[model samples]
Target: MTAKDLESLLTIYKEVVEKIDLGIHVIDSNERTVIYNKKMREIEDMDIDDVLDKNVMDVFHFGPAEESTLLQVLNSGETIPNVKQTYSNNKGQEITTINHTFPIRENGVVIGAVEIAKDITKLEKMIQENVYKKGDTRYTFDQILGNSAALNEAIETSKRATRTTSSVLIVGEIGTGKELFAHSIHNGSSRADNAFLSQNCAALPDTLMETLLFGTAEQAGTEGRPGLFEQANGGTLLLDEIDSLSPALQTKLLKVIQEKKVQREGGTEDLFVDVRILATISEDPIDAIAAGKLRKDLYYRLSVVSIFIPPLRERKEDIDLLTSSFIEKYNHLFGMKVAFIDEEVKSYFQEYNWPGNIRELEHVIEGAMNLMGHEDTISFDHLPIQFRHKSSSSGGSNDLEKIEGLLYQPDKAILPLDDYIHEAETYYITKALQHHDFNVTKTAKALGMSRQNLQYRIRKYNIGKNTHS
Candidate 1:
């Protein structure tokens, strides 16, 4: 190559090195600094005049006989692997940096040593914070609260899954606490000390998701962004609702999981990342794959540790526990003094088919607390009309016998449809009024009616004035 062309190439290379976020320094064979980058200057908080042509050891305050990785590399003419260290800047602020030193050669002869230092002060802080905050008590296996065989098996499976690095796939209906299981598994895993980053695949578009998961290169925009994989490195990544990922994005994600590397959009380099994958779906992944909504290969990869959270209705034994938990949560949040769910109200909750699962239960509890005001006990009066129907339909044999014995006898024929309807409405309205402390507004809303309408019905049915309001 011509000397002019070589000089131009060298200028471009130097400019590129100077602009990197990592500190770069070229030291002569004598172990003196020959060239240094802007990041090196900023890391030391120094002006060009203060650092130029200085011996590498002279710039920093190092103890005698305490050799640096750079010094060792220069002396042995060998490469030194990345070494993490703390150095004080000119402002006396200590920062963490990873340094790698290698011998620089010219004409096959070692002429100097080149060192690259990357500032990782923030990363170090995050690591320390994660280590110290290892035991977050937001959730536990006991929080699952179920005695059903299905639930017990699922919990056992989750416990087993936590011991491995295999990817997990959780499937359940909406509001079934799929995310809850994900959190429990992450907290139970060996990587509990690392960050647990979760993102719903259904929440973001393909383009945005790609950028969020794999980041963007410097050439893509002015500010380079780190992807979720990079941020969750050495941690767990929960991809909630993985079934919602488009086919194209599925291919990209498969590549990342398989290779454990990500090439940012518009960047040529592949970055290695270590992250445990946990994915969730509300639908049957096998059916979804058949329908072409999800990729088969991706499903197989994620199903290495599969778990299915049962809907609330299937685990009736846990209903009371979940109800009490929600009531406590809302009681503290809304400043309500509610202390218990009366048998009548608990019966209603247990009977209701919780299609929306635990999340729906939470909403129902919050709604009941709001309607019950500061009452110490939640009663059937606070339940909605649909819930009342469920209660009457599913209440124990004793409750059925009581209702039948009070209204009719075995010798009598079935009551007329209108009479039965009237009795049911009367029973629910009376119970609702009592639950709401006789507040017509709340009772009406719970029954999906207006105050005037409820009042008219109340007068027509000749219901008693047991309510105070």
Candidate 2:
């Protein structure tokens, strides 16, 4: 061919290569980049001058995965098709690409390879659309309402913690909404779609706890069951009241947390698991250890990222928000049109110590709504007995005297008031004692008093005549 004709042909070839959207590169056998098109420069957000003649490895880091693919293609002198890679451009933006590399031949001898890479970021994003959208419910950050600094900090910490893979331990008093925080973490996590399995350690018996946590083998009378751990694989597992777990079960749980594996009952094989463990303890694990109820090693493992939920009394500012929310919920559930709580009732709720926390508050509002008979508003009359007593006790020195003055009054007046006061005290104390099944420790907790104080009262009032020592 004539020189002019050859030059024109070469120009035409260059134009066609430049017009192609896929990035093209020719690398010599030594893995040195030789020729590259403008598309390659554009995709990498780099100038041709910065990349040409440079060793491919020197120009870009292929990560462990892409490096392996490159090595295979180079050693085999064959095409490596559809090798996916994720890399950042010069502008520091992540991009996904599907790369194809094939050996180049010169006179039947492999000289180098031609690499073509097609941008697949958009395609990859479309594939992940469902995963990205998972667990995005109607709830948002605003749904967690509390002005108290401690609660605000906990919420912020939870939000940040959601971005990590660390296990979380939530410790709080009973009814303080530990489960609520656990659900919030699950909903905000990447594994939210899998499953959120919760098990109350105290509620399950030792004989069944293992079967409930790890699957039980199939038997003649019963179908095989996948326990909470198995069901929560690739998701999250919430162990509520972790401190209440039996010592033997605690050992088993520690093993699972350490190994990320669980052995099903009546099965020899161990199953791999990928569940994120979240545990809660109403009682302090340290105290549990002192009481010989919880294993120290298990406590340490579960408490890797610990969160202590302040009691309602500690965060009194949140009482209004929590009460309002409960009022709305119970109003709907009880078929009540209650739109607002009386200001006095709100004050009483805010001022009174919520020993039972959010769960107790919910029950109180439910009870009030039921008593209102679907009234449009909740007033002081609808308040629970304890709450009403709290309001009355705060009225003035006169009301204060009714409680403290009982200790030192004339025998004549005391004779009549004593019976009345003692009757009221006995009623509540008996109810609390029964509610906690005569466990003095728990009854003291429910009554917001020390065990010693409760013991004294029980003795003074002559309660539990049949059981008392």
- lDDT of all predictions: 0.77, 0.73
Cα lDDT tens digits for candidate 2, 1-469: 9999999999998998888878988878787777789888877778887777877666675555446345456668878765666766445667766677788878977788887887656544433442122244334456676799988788888888789878999888998777778878888878767677666677646655676678666543234556667777788888777877788888988998899988887667788988899989888768888998878888788777888888988998887788788877776676667888876567657656677887778878887777887567787677676665654444323333444335466653454775767766876677557645688875675456799999998889888864331
lDDT of 1: 0.77
Error of 1 at 459 (Å): 17
RMSD of 1: 14.1
What TM-score do all the candidates reach, one by one? 0.56, 0.54
**Tens-digit lDDT track for model 1 on 373-426?**
657998767755555555444543334354542346867667788886777677
| Best candidate, TM-score | 1
Q: How many backbone clashes does candidate 1 have?
A: 2
Locate the minimum summed-lDDT window of 10 residues in model 1. Answer: 128-137
